[model samples]
Target: MDNLVKKVKEGIWSGRTDHLENKESFRYHQIVELAQLDTLDTEGKACVIIGFESDEGVRRNKGQIGAAKAPNELRSELAKLPWHVSSEKYVVDIGTIDCTGNDLEKAQQQLGDVVNQVLTKKMTPIILGGGHETAYGHYLGVRNYIGKAAKLGIINIDAHFDLRPYDEQPSSGTMFRQILEQDENSSYFVLGIQRYGNTQALFDKADELGVIYICEEDMHGEQLVQVNKAIEEFFQNNDFIMLTLCTDVLNAAFAPGVSASSPFGLSPNTVRSIIRIVSSNEKTLSFDISEVNPLLDENNRTVKLGAYLVNEAITSFLN
Candidate 1:
């Protein structure tokens, strides 16, 4: 753990510190506990924030590379949000795992170890990511905690199938294919897939892998009822579920700071509903948000939006 994660800097959590004793006056920075992974206490009813600071996978996949900066930027934005959960529940930041010198594989393994430890402490892991590759490490931790016999369902809110082949090397685009082909106990259900976002070969791969998915165009209004039904069925089938969001799944108009922009992606509200539903479920074990690039953002729009969405998940999990 020492080789992988560095404790978050104190300055990263700074924000308005009003009425130190009043719960109502609290902002996230005021209430969040900062701890080193090794010294963390045995605490339950808490959500631990782990940052995956790596974009090597995105670079390998031939996409923009600024997602490495997302973890702290998202933290800065989250620092100002009002704290609404009960006082007994906690939010803890355990710092970040950096992908130094293109060692994404090592960083990912390190992330998996930290995540496993967080779960072992009986806390929910809310991972802020470097790229969509974060899902694989997050998956590694969850599967480690639950054991091989337990069925794990991965609920990804994204525009691409991410089932691309990784024969040469694993990139951000090949995580799901790696998991489905390697772990029979794990299953995947993706929402907000775009018709043009993936190649026909990827679609065929998704089918071959028996993936359950809902296209972006069919995720709104009356159609949400059926979507909810599918989500419920997925929850019932798996022993545990892990939720991941790739910001690129949102319409480029709403989220422009991602590796891949989706002009016809799902709206923020639509994505929020799915996060709320999945995070609130008892079967759900962890949550991760990926591909938020501050370097490409419009006046921090995507970073702030990502923070709000993360708040939604944390609030739902604690409440």
Candidate 2:
């Protein structure tokens, strides 16, 4: 586990110090425990934070290459938020799975191993990702924890279907396709799909695979009622749910620091509502936030927004 994960640095959690002895004034940095994978132990409900430090998948998919730096950047932003979780619940940071050179597959497998360990201990894993490819490893861990017989429903909030073929190699765009083709117990439901973001062939592939999707345009105004109904139905059908958020699913104006920017993507409020709805569910196993490219951000706007969204998930899970 040590070889697979590099422990988080203490400095990354530093922030405003306000009454460290008082729980009422505590912030995330003041309460987050740093632990090692081999020695992790918790007596109460806990959420473990793990980072995937690689953009190899994005690079392979012919996208930008700077998402590798997102994990720590997000950590820095998250350190300052107010900690509102119950006293019985805890949050721990166990560090990251580093992808050296071009060994993306190995890194992803390492992430899966760590995630499996976290879940085995009865803790929720809040994964900060290198790319959308992080979903494959996230899925692997959840599937392993639950075994092969349980039905796993994946809820992706993204603008693209990401159903591209991976004949030669697996990339960020090929994760869902790989899962659907190989895992019969798994099902997929995507929200905020942009009509112009994906090619016609991809749409045909989604149809052939029997994917459940809602267009981005149909998710606004009063149309959300029908969307919520579909979400509820999806939850009822699957035995377990795993939620993944691709930062690019948000409008580029609000989230410019992603590998694939969506000009007509969902608003932050809408995305937050979905995160709350999904993460708070008793059957949802874990959550991952991917594709936040700090290198492309303007004045740390996107990173801050990503941190807030992650906080929303943590609060929902812990409450």
Compose the digit string of candidate 1's lDDT tens values, residues 11-61: 899898879899989999998999877777775699999999989999999
What is each predicted model's overall lDDT from 0 to 1? 0.93, 0.93
- Which 10 consecutive residues of model 2 have the lowest summed lDDT? 1-10
Task: Give candidate 2 misplaced runs (Cα > 4 Å).
Answer: none
Misplaced by over 4 Å in model 1 are none
User: By TM-score, how accurate is candidate 1?
Assistant: 0.98
Model 2 clash pairs are none
TM-score of each: 0.98, 0.99
Model 1 scores a C-alpha lDDT of 0.93
lDDT of 2 by residue, 1-319 (tens): 7678898876999899889689989999988999998888867999999999989999999999888899999999999999998788989999999889998888888888988999999999999998998999999999999999999999999998999999999999999999999999999999999999999999999999989999999999899889989999999999999999999999999999998897898999999999999999999989999999999999999999999999999999999
Clashes in predicted model 1: 0
